[model samples]
Target: MKGTGEEVVSLFYIGTAIMLFLAFGLLFIVVTYQRHFFRMKRKEAENMLKVSLESEKNERARIAADLHDGVSGDLSAIKNYLSVLAKKESENKEIFDEIREGVDAALQNTRAVSHNLMPPLLETEGLVPALKGYLESIGAKAQIYFEVTANGAVALPASVAYQLFRVLQELTTNMVKYGNVSKCDINIALNKEALTIDITDDGTPFNFRENLAKPNASGLKNINSRLHAVGGVIVQEEEKQVGNHFTITLKNVNNA
Candidate 1:
């Protein structure tokens, strides 16, 4: 009887141990699944933020282009009419001269503002010509040597061109603002599948990934968002010998 009771007690202990082990295994699985779910949710939220910012930037660019093409053009025509009036009424010297000077100054100011809003060449000509003109303008302003090379001559969609142009502008602005060193290089190549752009500046080297996560630094974030909107990806790196570099690859949306 004593031996049977001892055997029964040992069996009960073994059963309790097995139940505890199973419970721990179940708890670990639940915790792991919950952690994975939260991680996925966080990534989704970040993507949503990127989409929202890109939409806002696109809207701003559209409005600026419209103002330049519509309002600025009208202002230019009015200035031209004033010029004709001035030419015909040369005898009314004082009034005509005053009108001419004021109108001319106003016209000049309008052109400058329009250029800032959206380069007229971007609308009149194609992307390549517009980019060439931009590079020339930047070169004239700064001491830095800027080089641009385009491999193929394919007409890109206007929206794609505009977004890419803005991206290039951002890169140039950053180079001027932060990259204190001298020279910069820009290269654009297009193939059947994709368009690739590389911008390198001999400036102070900084880790883009580190800077991107910092608070209130919206430039890199904005660039990433714009690239994402256009089905493009941007990679940033700092080389040991070279400076900061950005490589942007845009998928051919028309094909897709």
Candidate 2:
């Protein structure tokens, strides 16, 4: 009877150990499956964003083409005919000049919008030069100075380049309108594992966490979505008290 009791006790201990091991193994598998499911969802979302961005680019290109080729051509023809009319009538010079000036202004606005819709520089020259051209265009409106610096540059994919350009555009626009800064600085660097970009404005301190929660922060949200689509991230950089600083990081990118 004593031997039987001992055997029963040993069997109970073995059964308890096996149950605990099974519980732990099941928990691990569940955790791993959840993580994998979340990752797949995130990848799907990013792919959706990529498709949306491509569609947006195509639409922009079509509209820009219409404005530049269709509208601008008609405006030029009108301007030429107006010039001829002004030449014919010497007494109505003032009236014609006013009309001509109006037409010229309209033409200028059209060209600007067309260029903004899809800048030729961006397609032909790449991101940096395209940004330089954009800065020069905006220089007349805002009393801002532009500085672009780089360290051992590597060519970025066109999609990445466009997204980065949009990010810079939004930053500069916000700085000009709200931050009240005069000078802008952009730094670009590339290494074996990452592409790092810093954009600093000498205006106000920026808080990414704060703005990210605001409902009206469409610009920042746009920036975030763009970065995420390209496997990059935008975070507010600290260690600078003078102005607003932001950093963009792209990881596991092949830099050549």
Candidate 3:
């Protein structure tokens, strides 16, 4: 009887060991699966970011081409006409005045082209100052009241700054083209580890999600892509009666 009891006890110990082993194996599998899932998600995010950056580059190239082939060409022709007028001005006072006016207009056109391509304020001052200047310029054109506020000590990395600047440019352009907005508020803040940008407009409400899903929604896609490249995310708020709200959060720019 004692031998039989000892045999039963040994079997019980063996069964408990097997159960533990199975449990541990299942735990390992679960952990491994989670790890792989996260890895795949991260890879997908990286790919999306790469695509976004490429799109932005393409858009910039398009803008540059338009400026060079269209606006710049026109301005060059105007300048040439003015130069010819100046040469003929010695014979006619009216021609001299007309040539002077043409030169002034051409100069203004050149400055406008330069502003559109790359604002001088951005190159001379930092991002904040540049943004302020840009917003003011847009506001003037649209007869909109745009305000900007910045807080905190986080200075952005150049790459991140450029991306964010482009995002803002797109947003402002959309507002001017579609939103019919007469007022806008832009705010930037930085916490210890993150930078936050908020842009709100008093315009007709937009269905952002629907727009994002459309086939040719390049602007929103570009914004999302740029934000991703900068280790940032764009959060669109629920539509309120007032307007659209966009919040962009970027990580590690302060440290970078």
Candidate 4:
């Protein structure tokens, strides 16, 4: 009976040991699984961010194409028809002129919107003229004075011009949307090796870091992406009693 009792105690100790071993094994597996799950989740989040950014660019291109190819063509036809009708109604010239003016305004607005979406001049005429046209168009509407001073001709490659144009457009948009909507100065200078653009606005100070983190601040993202494409760097300077000052630099300019 004593020996039987001792055997029962030994069996109980073995059972307890087995339970502990199983528990530790289960914990190890669970921890490994959790680590893998978290890693996959992080990767998925990064991929989603990339997809969203690319989607925005694709959507912009699609909308620009639709406006340029569809809406602009219709407006051009309407303007032509209005011109013919006005000539036919020479007796009531004043009424026709009024109607013609309305049509002309509509056509002009359509073209402006199209140009703003995708500026053909940027591709054809080059960057400086494109910037001038864009600034002039927006300035007329916003009634804000913009001064662009180019010390030397900015003859950039086509690809570089496109990216730089986008960066400037984004900056101008941000300035108009958040700045004081007053006069802004743009200085473009080309050195022997690099190109630089300095834009200073006379508006409220901007929080660059905070704004860039906001979800709705896609324009800031776009600016970063464009700069990245051109291998450029951006520097923001704070000015007392002045608005946001942005400096963009492109080094080792390579032709596309």
On lDDT, the candidate that comes out on top is: 2
What's the true lDDT of residue 52 in model 3? 65
What is the per-residue lDDT of model 1 for residues 1-256, given as tens digits with 9 covering 90 to 100? 9999999999999999899989998999999999999999977875786567557656665766666677667767777787788788878867867776776777667656657557667767867788878877776787778888888674787767767877787778777777785888888888877888888888888787788899876888777767766779988854656588888898875542
Encode model 2's per-residue lDDT on 110-170: one tens digit a residue: 9999989888787787778888889877866898887878775456777778878888888
Give the whole-model CA lDDT for all candidates, comma-separated: 0.76, 0.85, 0.80, 0.79
TM-score of each: 0.68, 0.89, 0.69, 0.67
Query: How does model 3 fare in lDDT?
Result: 0.80
Give the poorly placed runs of model 2, Cα more than 4 Å off: 89-92, 151-154, 191-193, 252-256
Higher-TM-score candidate among 1 and 3? 3
Worst lDDT 10-window in candidate 3: 117-126
Count backbone clashes in candidate 2.
Answer: 0
> Which pairs clash (backbone N, Cα, C closer than 3 Å) in model 2?
none
What TM-score quantifies how close candidate 3 is to the native fold?
0.69
Order of candidate numbers by lDDT, starting with the best? 2, 3, 4, 1
Candidates sorted by TM-score, best first: 2, 3, 1, 4
Instruction: For candidate 3, write residues 1-256 as lDDT tens digits.
Output: 9999999999999999999999999999999999999999998988877676767655665675576667767766776776777677666857766766776676677667656666555545667888888888788978999999999434776556767888899988999999989999999998877888899998988987799899899999887777777778888888898789999888787543
Regions more than 4 Å wrong, model 4: 1-74, 86-102
Ten-residue stretch with the least lDDT total in model 1: 49-58
lDDT, candidate 4, 12-124, per-residue tens: 99999999999998999999999999999977765665456456556666777787778877877877887888788889878877876887787777777767766878778
